[model samples]
Target: MSAARDSKSLSGIAINNSPHVQQLQKTAPPHLGLVCITFSKEVRFRTITRTRYLQLPEEQRETALKVLYRENLQRLDLALTFCVRNSIRLYRMPSGLFPMSDLEDEIGATVLEKMSADLAKIGQRAERLGIRMVLHPDQYVVLSSDSPHVVTTSLKILDRHARTLDLLGLPRSSWSLMNIHGGKSQRADQLVGVISELPENIKSRLTLENDEHAYSASEILQVCQRAEIPLVFDAHHHICHENLDSYDHPSVAEMLYAARETWANPDWQLVHISNGEEAFGDRKHSDLITAMPNVYREVPWIEVEAKHKEEAIARIASAGFF
Candidate 1:
């Protein structure tokens, strides 16, 4: 495919290496997303943990919260602009984009109001640039858990993510997906059941992904098919999953084709690509992607989970792999 429109500077938010981005224009359909952090030294993103915030002296904590939130919001704005310039069509926004927004009830409410304007503006920026946004809710969102406490906590975490999207003005639709795993449970039925209980707003944005540990491509596909959730087939994770048996399994190409069936508009289908650290199923991510699955060339979008971020995208571009 032809490259996207040229990215003019946005609000003077300096993108560190846009010249590199411009040269790596796409020749195809599956655009790559740089997972969260960038290699840009001028724009390092920061996030704060809830524990550290709680441990601070009450007085000292107040200023600390606003500073981190402001910095991250500004970073989010810059990242979207970077994607536009880089021809990076997709972006998996950091799950921790807003620290402790839902964990501390009193604080979350205050922070949300302060962040409303920036969030709304950036959401508009993403859509206008035609940059698809993806949010992979972190390990903390365990909706499949049986315990009410864990499930409740997980709900809060998800709500926080959904709320962020709402403020950002992304429609509650597949245009922007909130991709996640099946969580710590093995029972596909349990996960499917949990999907039934979710609010439509959250459910609408949710897309289940197959992970290396708990969920395999087929198992998660069962949930997707049953629950009507879109499948985000992870090529590396599918290779490394624990469920492959002595019996023959489907090839990566076949599984990806099957997963693509879950999406309504096939053009928006997404897949995750990452290289294993040492061997095929190791959870650790390689700093750079040596190669990508040929099947992915037919797919719509990809999120590269490499430690080197933008450099990895440049690697595949320079090689003309896609």
Candidate 2:
């Protein structure tokens, strides 16, 4: 395989934050997945909301949280083992891997201490096995939110993600992407200033992505240029809504090229793919991909969003779009 295209990259990894996945399977028993539940037992991930977690009795909270954190790390370790077994190189580490991890600095420090050894083991295995870990935080984590409280919370959440990568020993670079969307319509200056002031660990791996609403490829490309951060152009999101005419827009390829240019490494440049479940413009993701933009042919790490998770990836691999 050429350096430009990894055969492993050809087999896109799976993530389960999509609403459709949540709708299909309500969480199963605790014996099945400890505190969190998964769409499939094989792909264990998902977390209780902060509200529910806080509702737990004070005496039971720490013990409950300890179980959640420990099992999450175990699931992650198993995820790496699964990757090595399948020869897959790219995996999206679950955003809520540690439930309420971003609650506060003291809480984060205490939790990190408990799992430092597990983190090191997982990091070493990922390094030894050649896997690339990336993250797309919860949609509610918006740096562009108009509210100062929201902005501060987003900072804490993002800081937790960066700290996780640091613990895992992933490079402080886009190669270990902490991808998030420009989900709000706040003034560019405010958003850019917040990004500019981020710690080097967070800013170095930070990536901005276009969304189906609010921010478009053109809008985010400009932000990426200004922030000097990589842009993860989601082809389906771009097709659903953009200033440019849907798929046939000649500029789509140019946008992909420009977004690709934002990344420091060609091999680490990322893109996202998902098709509508019902109609072309429907925001809901389909269980399997029916088509892919030809323009993404040369892009590396095309993260697929589908309800079926890895099954969709297997179908795409056999379908021969690449």
Stretches off by above 4 angstroms in model 1 are 1-27, 57-62, 242-250
Cα RMSD of predicted structure 1: 10.2
lDDT of 2 at 114: 72
lDDT measured at residue 190 in model 1 versus the true structure, 0 to 100: 76
Q: Residue 69 of candidate 2: its Cα lDDT?
A: 82
For TM-score, the strongest prediction is: 1
lDDT of 1: 0.75
Residues 233-314, model 1: lDDT tens digits: 8877887774332111335666777788898877788888887677444668888776466556667788888988999988
Please write out the lDDT profile of model 2 over residues 1-322, one tens digit for every residue.
3211222333332223333222112132100001122236785865677787788886766777778888888888888777666555678887888877777525545777677888888888888887788888888788888899999989988988888888888899998889898968746677788899999999999999988787888899888889999998887788777533244345556667778777778567778877678765578988766666555555657676777666666666676565
Compute the lDDT of residue 97 as modeled in candidate 2. Answer: 87
